[model samples]
Target: MTVMTDRPHMTTEEFEDLARIAAQQAEGLRLEFIGGVLRSKAMPDGDHGRVILWLTRICMQHHPDFWLHPGQGIKAEQYREGRAIPDGVLAHEDAFVGQGDWVDPGPILMAVEVTSWDSDTERRDRIERPRAYAQTGIPVYLLIDRLKCQVLVHSDPDGNGYETVRTVPFGKEVKLPDPVGITLHTEPLKDWVR
Candidate 1:
C-alpha cells in the first residue's frame, strides 16, 4: 500500500524541473513523484539493462508496431498529479510524438518495471508503481522482480489497483494478456537475475 502523507513534498511541476536539471548533472539521477512524495530512482545495474533489452526484443518481435521505450516519463495517478518514469513504456511507435517530457497514460499499452538492486526496491517497484499505474488506467503492469525471482503480470485495472495479478516464477512461460498480446519465455530471465 502507498503511504499517503498530509501534504506532498513538492508539486509535480517542481519535481519535473528538478528532475530535468538532475538529468543534465554528472550523476544523472532520476526522480519520481508518486503518492505525493518525491523519490529518487536508483540507477539500473548491468543485469537490469539486460532484462529490459530482453523484454524489448520480444515485444518488438511479437508486435512490430509497438515499441518498448525505456525511461519514458508518464503522468500517473487518478488525478494525473504524479510523475513516474517507468523502466519501459510499451506503446505504438509514434505514441509519444510531439509530447513533452511527461506524456499522458492513455496510449500506454503496458508499464514495465525490472526491479533495481536497491534498498527501496520493495516499496517503490512492488507497491507504488502498480497503484500509480492502475489509478491512471494503464492496461497492464509487468513487474520483473529480481529479488523475488518472479514475474508478476498485473492487469484489469479498477482505479484502486489491478484486479487480476498473475505471478510466475522465472523459467516459466507467462502470457501477457491483450492490449499487450505476447508470451514471454522467461528462461532467459533466469540468467539475467542473481
Candidate 2:
C-alpha cells in the first residue's frame, strides 16, 4: 500500500494496499493504515522506545496469553476511515496476524499510549483519543506521559467516553485492572525519562 504523507497524495485505495505490502516486505518497518494512507511514524527514540518495550514485557509476563502489539495500528472503524496505531495494544484471545487491513472492534482489555513532547498531542492522547476508545467500549486506556513523568489510567468507560478514575505520578503506585489481579510499581521506570 502507498503511504500518503507530506504534500503529495494518492487515492485512498492505493495507500491501503501499499501499507499492507510494507508490513509484509519488511520485518523491522512497522506500517499502519491511517486515513487510507499508510503513515509510517518515526521509530521511537531509544530511551522512550525502551520504556514502551519494558511495559509490554511486564504486561506480557503477567498475562501470558495476550498478544502485545507495539506500534501496530488498530482499525477502529474500517468503513468510516477511522484508525489509530496505539503504542501498546493488547490483543487478547486473538493471536497477532502479521498483515491485516483491519482489526476487530475490541473490548481490548488495555490500550497504552506513550506521549510525545507536544502539549496538543498530550491532550489528544490523554483525553480525545481515549474517549473514542471508551465509546467503543474498550475497558482500559493507559497513558504514560514521559514528558510529564506521570501515568494516567482511564477506566470505567460510560456510553460516551472514558472518565478519569485515577492518576499517579512518577514515584506513586500505578495499578490497572487485569485478569490476574496484579498491581505494578513504577518507580523503576523513572530512569527512562531521558
Candidate 3:
C-alpha cells in the first residue's frame, strides 16, 4: 500500500482520488501526494497524539477565530500538484464551507508536523514538507521534533522556503506570530519513542 516513487507525476485530481480511496480503506493510515510524489504513513503514536491534542485544546480555548484540524489534507497549488496531510493544521473558522476532507493552502494559518519514528519520515517532515508548504505560500509551518526534543517555527515564506525560523527546547514557550498570535507550551511534550 506504499505509494513512494521517484516521479509519481500524478495530476491533482488523480492524487485526490487516490487519497479518497485510501482513506476509505485504511483508518489510521495517511496517504498524501507531496512534491509530485505520493507518500503514506501510519497514525502517530501516543506522545505525538498528545502533543496535537494539547495544541488543539489551546487553540480552541484561546483562539476563537481559528479552527484546529488533526490529520487533514491540504492542497497547495505551487508544489507541482500534490496534497499534503500535516499532523495538525490551524486555519480560519470559515476556511471550509461544508463537511469536506480537503482544504486549500490559501486559508491555512499554520501547518504542523510531529516527527515520526522512522528516519525517512523525519527527513520528509523536517525538509521536504516545509519547502512544499512555503512554495504554496503557507504563512507558518511548525515542526515538533521529538527526536531533538525541540520545536521549530518557520514563517515568512519566500516562495522556495521560509525566511524566519525560531527553534526552542521542550521546556520553552515558542510564540506564534500575528494572526495566530499565541505561545505554545512545549514543556509537557515527552519523547515517548526515545
Candidate that scores best on TM-score: 1
Worst 10 residues of 1 by lDDT: 1-10
- RMSD of model 2, in Å? 5.3
- Model 2 lDDT tens row, 1-194: 96545532554456567666776898756554443343454456777788787887787788887755776566552243446677777766464555465465563677778776654565557655676577666677888878878888877888467665677888887778753244668886698886
Q: What tens digits encode model 3's per-residue C-alpha lDDT throughout 55-171?
A: 888988888778887777777647447677888889877777673777767778889888888857665887788889899888889888888889899999999899999999888
Count of clashing residue pairs in every prediction = 0, 5, 0
Arrange candidates, best TM-score first. Answer: 1, 3, 2
Q: Per-residue error at 190 for model 3, in Å? A: 3.2
For every model shown, what is its TM-score relative to the native structure? 0.95, 0.73, 0.88
The residue-level lDDT of candidate 3 at 83 comes to: 79
**Candidate 3: residue 105 Cα off by (Å):** 1.7
Off by over 4 Å in 2: 1-42, 77-81, 96-99, 118-120
Better of 1 and 3 by lDDT: 1
Cα deviation at 72, candidate 1, in Å, is 0.3
lDDT of 1 at 19: 85
